[model samples]
Structures are given as C-alpha cells and as structure tokens.
Target chain A: MKKFINQADDFIPEMLAGIYLAHPDALRCVNDDPHCLARVGATPGKVAIVTGGGSGHLPLFLGYVGEGMLDGCAVGDVFQSPSPEQILAVTQAVDTGAGVLYLYGNYNGDIFNFDMAAEMAEMESDIRTRTVVAADDSAGAAPSGEGNASARRGVAGIFFVYKCAGAAAANGGCLDTVARVAQKAGDRVRTLGVALSPCIVPRIGKPGFQIGDDEMEIGMGIHGESGIRRGPTLPARQIADEMMSWLLADSPCQSGDEVAVLINGLGATPLEELYLMYRHVHHTLSQSGIRVFRVWVGEFATAMEMAGMSISLMPVDEELKALLAREANTPMFRQFSA
Target chain B: MKKFINQADDFIPEMLAGIYLAHPDALRCVNDDPHCLARVGATPGKVAIVTGGGSGHLPLFLGYVGEGMLDGCAVGDVFQSPSPEQILAVTQAVDTGAGVLYLYGNYNGDIFNFDMAAEMAEMESDIRTRTVVAADDSAGAAPSGEGNASARRGVAGIFFVYKCAGAAAANGGCLDTVARVAQKAGDRVRTLGVALSPCIVPRIGKPGFQIGDDEMEIGMGIHGESGIRRGPTLPARQIADEMMSWLLADSPCQSGDEVAVLINGLGATPLEELYLMYRHVHHTLSQSGIRVFRVWVGEFATAMEMAGMSISLMPVDEELKALLAREANTPMFRQFSA
Candidate 1:
C-alpha cells in the first residue's frame, strides 16, 4: 500500500514522463498528453500496432513497443483503462499513411474505449483501423459457455499476439493481415491462473481481495475475480497439474500437437517456483500428447504482487511458427530470424 | 512454503529438462550435466560469453543465453553458486576453438569457484579465459574503504555488462577486448537496493530474514545481505531518493554524464510501484546533474518474493555508448546496433 508519488492524480503522468526520459531513443509520449506512449518514428507502410490497458504490467503494453513490436501504447492508471480520448490520440499519433491496427487486451473498459477510438480515427483522421482483441484467459469466461472464445479476458497471453502480429506488420503485411495474425494467435491461445493472495492498489492502500494464509484460489482472474474453486495450498506440482488439466481440456492439442507454453508468474511468484511449475507443466503437456515447440517461463504479464501464476498454450502452425520465430528487437523480447 | 517440486534435490535437473524441451533451438544442456546449459550450435570464433549464478534469478543468467548474449550458463541451487567443476564443464562446452570470457556476478563463492575454473581451463584445455565480475552494488562497499572499484558487489547491473560484452563479442571483439568492455561497464555502474520483506526460499521453507511489518531496509544485498540501515517504510519517492543518493555519491557524475538507469524490482514490488519509483529516481538523477540516456525498469534480477528494489546507474562514454546501443538478440535483451 505504501507508494511513492507526489499526488495520486499525477501518478500516471509522472510515471510516463519518467519512462520517456529513461527510454528516449526507444519511446516517446504524445506531444501534450503524457498518457499516450508511442515508439518514435514515421512507421510508414507498416501497419502500426497500438495496445494499451492498465499501467501495472510493464513490458507488456509499453516495454513491447519498439522496432519489431507495438508502435504505440496508451496507458491508464494502475489496473484502469485509458480514457477514450487518450486512446484516440494514441491511435492518431501512430497512424502513418498506412492503416493502423489496434491490438489490446479484452478487458471491458479497454474494449469499449479502443473500439470507440477505432471509429474516431476512421471518421476524423481518414485512417482505416482494425482491431484484434486478445481473449486468452480461460478463467475469465465459463469454459462450457463459449469454448475459449466468448467474453474471455485477456491476460499474459497478449505478449504472444504482439510478437506474431508485430512480425507480420514488420514484414509489410497490411492492417488486415496483421490483425488476422494477431487474432489467430489470440484464438489459439488459452490461459488459466490461480492466486495465493490479492494485490494492494497503491492508491487504495489495501488488498483487493483476501485469501487465507494457507489457501489459494484456482482459475483466478488477474484482477482477483472469483475463481472456479479455492483449496488448501498444495505443492507446486499438484497446482501445475490442476491448471494444466483445465488448459488441456478442449484444447486443439492432441497427441503430437505442437504448442507453445508460457508459465507466467503473477508478480510475486519467484522465478525458481515458476521453473518448478514449468517442469510439471511440461511434463503434463508431454503426457497429454503435445510437443512444446517454444516456451517462455517468466513474468511476461503480472497482477501486481499477487502470489500466483497462469499457464498459456498456443497451438502453432508453420506460419505461426515462422512469425513467432521472426526477429524481435524490443526492450523486453528478442528473437533471431531463422 | 508450498513449492512445485517433488523433492528439493530434483528442482534444478527437472527445470533444466523442461527448459531444454521448450527451447531446443535456442538452448541445450550439457550431456548428463544438468548444471550446464548452453546454446545449440553456437557460433565459433566469437569470444564465448559465460554467466552463471543461483537459480532464483530468472532471465538473469539463464534467460540471457541466446544469439547475442551469454553463450552458456551454469545454474546452481537457489541463491547458491555452481560448483567449480560445473562452471568448468560449461566453460569447456561453450568454448568453440575460441577462448572464453567468464562474466559472472561478484559473489565470493562465484568468484572463487570461477577463478579456480579459469585456472583449470588454462592448465587442462588450450582455452584462455578472462574475467569480468559485475561489481555494481554500491551499497555493499564503503566509499572510503576499497573504493567502488574493488568492494562493489554485483547485482542487476550485470545485465548491462551482458549487453555490452555480448555485443562486443558478437561483433568479433577479441577475448581481451570483450573482457575490457565488460569490465568498463562493470566499473562505471553502481547499484543500491532496499527490501520491504525478506524473500522465502522455497527449499529453505522460511523467510531469508525478518523485518517489522511497517519497516524497510535500504542497501540490502540481492541475497538478503544486511543493509546499511533499516527504518520505518517511507513513501516510494523518499525511498527512491535514499537509494539514488547513495548510488550517485559513489559515482558522482558531471553535467552530461549520460547513463543507463535500471529500476530493478526485488521480486515482490509491483511494476506500478517500480514505475512510481522510476519517476522519482529519474527526477532525482536530473537534479543531480546526470542525464539518463537509456533506462530499463523491470524485475531483471530478483530475490524470490522480497518486496524491494535496486537502482543501477552506468556512466556511458562513446565506446560504452556504442556497446550499450549495440544490437543484442537475446531471449531477454535486445537493442538496435549503435
């Protein structure tokens, strides 16, 4: 709950200014509105990619903007979506002569504002805009209701979409192509999370939710949404199996299905534990007839200092594999072009 | 104390197997040796860059091995150094006709063991090795004692050396040149840390240290070494000031000393707070006549779930600037070539 800020209202602006100052060569804020952070340059002919949501997930929306990733990001306060006007400004700023692509998480506020901004850019700026909403968090929606596609919330799996879409855009794909690739990546990905405790918002000065000292909630949302179940804290292997079962059920992966696995730590989870969880997750996936072609086990996306983790699986094809394998020269992600 | 491992002893080997299965193209482990992880078909004639440390810090020693960063990493148990024999095996495995450069942290165990391995390599294999220990933690050393040059302890600033040396070596710098560049980066850098709570090592099943609920310790080592002082928790801005003041005092910069600033979270600090800390740290640096040319704020090096952060500064010159800006295509770090 203890935070370092001059004023609660000025926190986002102050943070953006600092990010710009720190990464001047790699990032810049919109001329007046500090909330709109964008990669500097006229990315002409390339489908400009813009993603934004809350502010707590570093390297997610902002750290991902660079040569081969997002072109701009509109930031909100911690766990809050940017205003519609902020999104509009970022969309306009990043729109080169080529059309722009709006890629963001599927949080309610973000979905509403980004959609409004897309319409605004088309109407006023004569810039065509398309969108790809990342809906990878299976825990956000009822599994039997929509089959991983309906009303699903975006979580850490947004990073995979960014990489695939950015590579497509960088390869001179049109806005539609870039959007399609991102959408495909989003569709193929699914995530399930569990939380050991709730996070404290800096301004709120208290935990967002409560968990018993020896309890953990399975299939929890990033914002502490009620999970499918709560149980006594179990060993990490059992927890990994429990999460992997949900992800593997109804998965396109069968025996011999190639997939990418991401064992994401929700802020407070240590890397050591993440690797341990990854060990079990890999074992489970292998036993379930899936070959993990690529894996990223780290804190790609986070939920404050919440002590939990999520597992995301993305079925990969040759094109998806090639795009995923493309070189990305971002501050956070790097890959060599094969 | 709940962990994912079936047994504490199996943690490292199991994690290595999982990493190898996931990134077979990007990484591989030595035959029958789980401690040594190396890149597959790594380029020859380039100065082989090696880094290793405890297993808890993700993306530090292991996540950095790829095309343009470290060639190999020897991972030890949580917060412990790999044995000299493990270090020697990795060194030999990564050495491809070219001599190797050992770039590791400055912990006493690591230094002594790696030094012994370097000597063993000299006598056994025809491999010549140079060393560049990351001595960047300013708080660990007294200014008047051995000076920052000798007494500093390595922390997150090791990433900067990984970047510079990786670039230099990738650009065909000789072993000595790569070591010199890494050493220069190590020399110009300084870090200071603070912890709100001690991290609990999973295997140890207990907190590393104790602190009052409302108290924090500044200048704490990465492995929970006692800090310079412990006091009641203050706002993030004051904590940022305290950390920056000590770091800047150790390496007083002039008006135009371009530097790279890293606001590293010690595991449990949220990105929201880290960004807030970054805001204050940037402002403090500006007021101190230092200009930050590059900035990275993230959980680069963590100490389990310790609620703390460390700020690192590296003064940049033309050569250092070029090396810093050089393209590094690693799994965790990337920058445009200078």
Candidate 2:
C-alpha cells in the first residue's frame, strides 16, 4: 500500500522529531539519540519508567509518556519492536539516581530486546533495573499455563500496569517496589481480544491476515496471531461471555474480589457497540459476584481499524486501587484520585 | 461490508443497553427511553451538557460522557442525528435543578433537531437552555456564511470544547456562563480535515466517497462532504500545510496568539505518520508566530478508518486556558498539569 513516508528507514526518526515539536511542553527527545522520547521535567530521583514498542500504536508508547506515567519511550517502525540499541538508549536516558524500571507488553521481540537492554544497563551504568512484562491476554495461553510465563500474552491491558507502575515509581518507590506492584497488577490482569478483520500496515499495503465476512477469530494476538477458533460472528452477549469465561478461568480472584473492568474497542468497533459488550461483561461479572471499582471502556489499545473488542479485568486491592487512582497526567491516562 | 449488528433498527437500542450495563456506576439510561444515556450522579442544578451525533464515532459522543465531562449524551443511529424527540428526552432527563446547555457538532440535521428540543423544553418546563454548535471545520463553510454561522463544520475539534465547557459547567457555572464559554471556545477554534479514503457505514456497506490510491482529498467533511480540492497524494509536510492554511484563515486571532493544538488522526492514520504531520504543523505554527500552550495528538475524533488527519487551533485566553488546564477525568480525556 502507498504511504506518505519519504523513506522507510527515516520513518521513526522523522516521527519522533514531529512528536517533540508538537509536544514541546509535555515531551522532549533525548539530546543524544533522538530516538529516545522522554517526558519533559521527568523526576530525577524516582525509579524511571521506560517503555518501547512499534510505532503504529500512537498513544500507547508516546502518548503515555508524560507527567504521571511513563518517563521515556523508544519507538520503532510500525508494528515492529525497537532494536536493542534503541531500547538501551531510552533506558539510559530515563535512569535517574534511583535506577530505572522497564515496562512493556509481552511481545516476543520486545521481551528479548528489553531483557538484553536491562542486562547492558546493569553492567555499563550503575543503574539497577527491573522488568514487568504485561501478559494479560488469557486467550493465547492454555489452561495449564494459566498464570505461567509461557502462556501469558500482553494485549491492551498493558495500560493498566503502566498506570499502576508509573504511579508507584512517581511516588518514590524503589525499583523493586515498582516492579513488584507492576508484576502484581499484571498477574491479576487477564485480557482476551477478537478481530473482525486484519489491519493493513502502511508499509505492507495489505492486511496481515484474512478474515471472512461472516466470521471472527477469538483469542487473537495483537499481531494477528491465529486465535483459538474462527467461527460465525456471534452476538455481543455471546462474544462477551466467551471472552469473560476464559479471562475468569485464568484469574485467581473469586466472585467477591474487587476489580476494574476495561472493555476496549479493537480499533473499528464503535463506542455504542463497546457499551453493549460492556453491558454483557458487567452482567457476567456481577453474576460472578465481582464488584467493579472502576470501568474504562474505549479504544485504549487499538489495532488500526480492525473490527472487534477485548475485555481486560484487573483485580484491585487497596494498594493497587490506590495506585490506579493516583493522579496521572499522561496524554492518554488520567486518574486524579489516589 | 458485513457488520456485527443484528438489524439496522436495533443498533442504537442494543448499544445503549450495553453501555448502561457496563458502566452502571458511570452512566445510566433514562427511566423510559433507553436511547438517552446520562452520567449516574448528574443531578439537577448543575449546568447540563449534552452532545450527540451518529453512532460510528465511538469515543466521540458516548465515550466522552463521564466524570468531569459531559453530563449526558443522546446517541443517534449510525452516521445519523438523533430525532428531535430523542434529543428532548435526554435534555429533560439531564436538566437537574439548573438549566441545560446543548453542545454538539455542526451538522444541519443535528442543529435542527437540537434547536427544536431546546424550544420544547423552554415552553414546557422551568428549565432554561442555550446552544453552542462546534463549527470548527474551515473547509466545509461556503464563502457567504463566514463568521458565527458560516465557516462552521464540526469534526474532531469538538472534543476540546467538550472538555473546556464540561469543566466550566461542572464547576457550577450558570447556563449563560457555560454557554458563553463553550461558544467562545467554538469561536476561537478552527479545524481542517482531509481524507485519503471515505468511510463505509455499517448499514451502507460501501464507501461514502471514492478516491484513487495515489490521490487524497483536502478539506473533506467528516460525512463525505466535498473538500477544498482533490489532488495527487502529497508528502506529510505538504499535507500538513494544506490543513494548517485553512485553520489559520478560520481563526480570528493573529500571530502571537497562544492556542491549543489538536492533531487528530482520522481512525486509519498510523501514529508514526501522525507525528510526522505534527512535526510540520508545529514548525508552520512557529513560523507564523503562534504560541502553542498545549498540544494533543491522537485519534480524538475518528471517521472509521478513513485515512486522513485534522488540525484544530483554539486561541487561548485566561478563562479558556484555566478551563483547559482544569483536570478532566473521562474515559477519553485526561489532562494533568505539571
């Protein structure tokens, strides 16, 4: 497909420059590498929070880096993880005197690069580092790997962990404390997404996958991985039930547990339909005796205009709730009550 | 062309039911009419803000209604305005002890219906009402209707007004004051949008307009209205200039005017490209002596994967700046002052 880019290789650099210009008050590019985008006036003594991913997810990586959320973000090309060098650059730039914490989705390439970068930071700089990978998608894991690393896959639910972890780090928590809170939030969270159609990456010009007009793939990965099953499109109620069943099965919380519900539209799904799905999700959660402390329903994490929805549930205790409620001033995340 | 909806007629009601169920704490349906959605704790006496449009724009009308934002929203069918009766029902339900203020995009059908509803409420009830139409699209106005009524087409910039007006109303501003602020925001605001491709309504199953792969339309309206001109697809920088020129002309403020800039992706544009465009927009604004106080870049107002972007400039004054700086806690908007 045709794109407006001048050259494929320059896409990331040019985009970062643009972001810096538009949001000079809120963000600035690292003076050295230019690829590392950091929040303006990020605290120096706090455990810095760094995240990076492909560039297509606008607010996901860049928009989240501001006042109360991410300290810095390294953006790669569309739908592709940044290189190890880029990740390390962002890590080094955001590392305050207290060290740095790495937070990102559980994509395979991202994990490899971020892990390598963490090791490099520890050896090269005096910076201590911790990693909390978001593995919230329950649809990708088998029942046996319910809570295991092998079965966990990160989806849109990463935003919640970013909120909780960023607040923890911003509040003067050490690397260990911030990582623990993020891990706890990740463990309690479960997400399942479905896509009606595949997204067309501008570089590729065509969809990454082919979905029939009459069908939708459940349990699909964010990168359009093959889902558990492809079946006739079901009603919103049925879809909500199917996804919620998998999420609840993977979650350790009981019916009496308090949680936050995020009914995210996978790009093309309208808000009206999202609310419909949220209705079903709320009813299902109510039937299970879960008390939803908060509800976030929108395109928090989107895949272009891919039509579908994902449901993420995060069990919240007093501490997690407090972190989630803390005042956050990021472009995409804002919760004023701690 | 297929859609998840069961029937064209059932679309709105089904979606409303789902929203109420999902956000029982944040939103509620009118006792009798399910189509009217209101915030849960929105009592009378507070200035009520109501906005609505077609159903396709997800977070725009419905997702925007929550804490610190809209008091209520009346959702129409896909890409269609709500009936006069529907608008009246929501206005009556939302009018607490104070009067109601109607805020929405500038579209003929919406204006006609909302005006009728406001008149009905004045005649039948003790509530007073005022209206502020978000006519920010600089491309759609005919040369004759230049000022308040002309040069008015509401696209994505409405989100900014919602935040500013909602904050004012939520702070207990009287209906007149709320209307004044909203109108001021609308007046200072100017938006220009262009589309690479037209959006297909779920029920329509075909694109609203046609464009070649190598061509783009400038100054297009959200609902397939004609733009300024159709030309070969241009680079990001050139496209940014085309959009900025219109916005600058539409604004009454001159160079040195501090304004809030919103670089909105029309659903399909990638974040990477958005930043690229943002870069050009920032440089152009600086060259013109405009001081950008705040810049928000994202898919705030989308047109169902239509490949385009819109730029909105709202000249800021003390009151407008304060309202913009005030905390907004909604599903879609969250701003934290550093």
Top-lDDT structure, candidate number: 1
- What TM-score would every model get versus the actual structure? 0.92, 0.89
Task: List candidate 2 stretches off by more than 4 Å.
Answer: A2-4, A42-45, A143-148, A203-205, B2-4, B42-46, B66-69, B96-98, B142-151, B170-173
lDDT, candidate 2, residue A141? 74
DockQ of 2: 0.49
* Clash pairs, model 1 backbone: A4-B236, A236-B3, A236-B4
lDDT of 2 at B235: 73
Superposed Cα RMSD, model 1: 2.7
Candidate 2 A-chain TM? 0.93
Best by DockQ: 1
Query: Each candidate's iRMS in angstroms?
Result: 2.5, 2.9
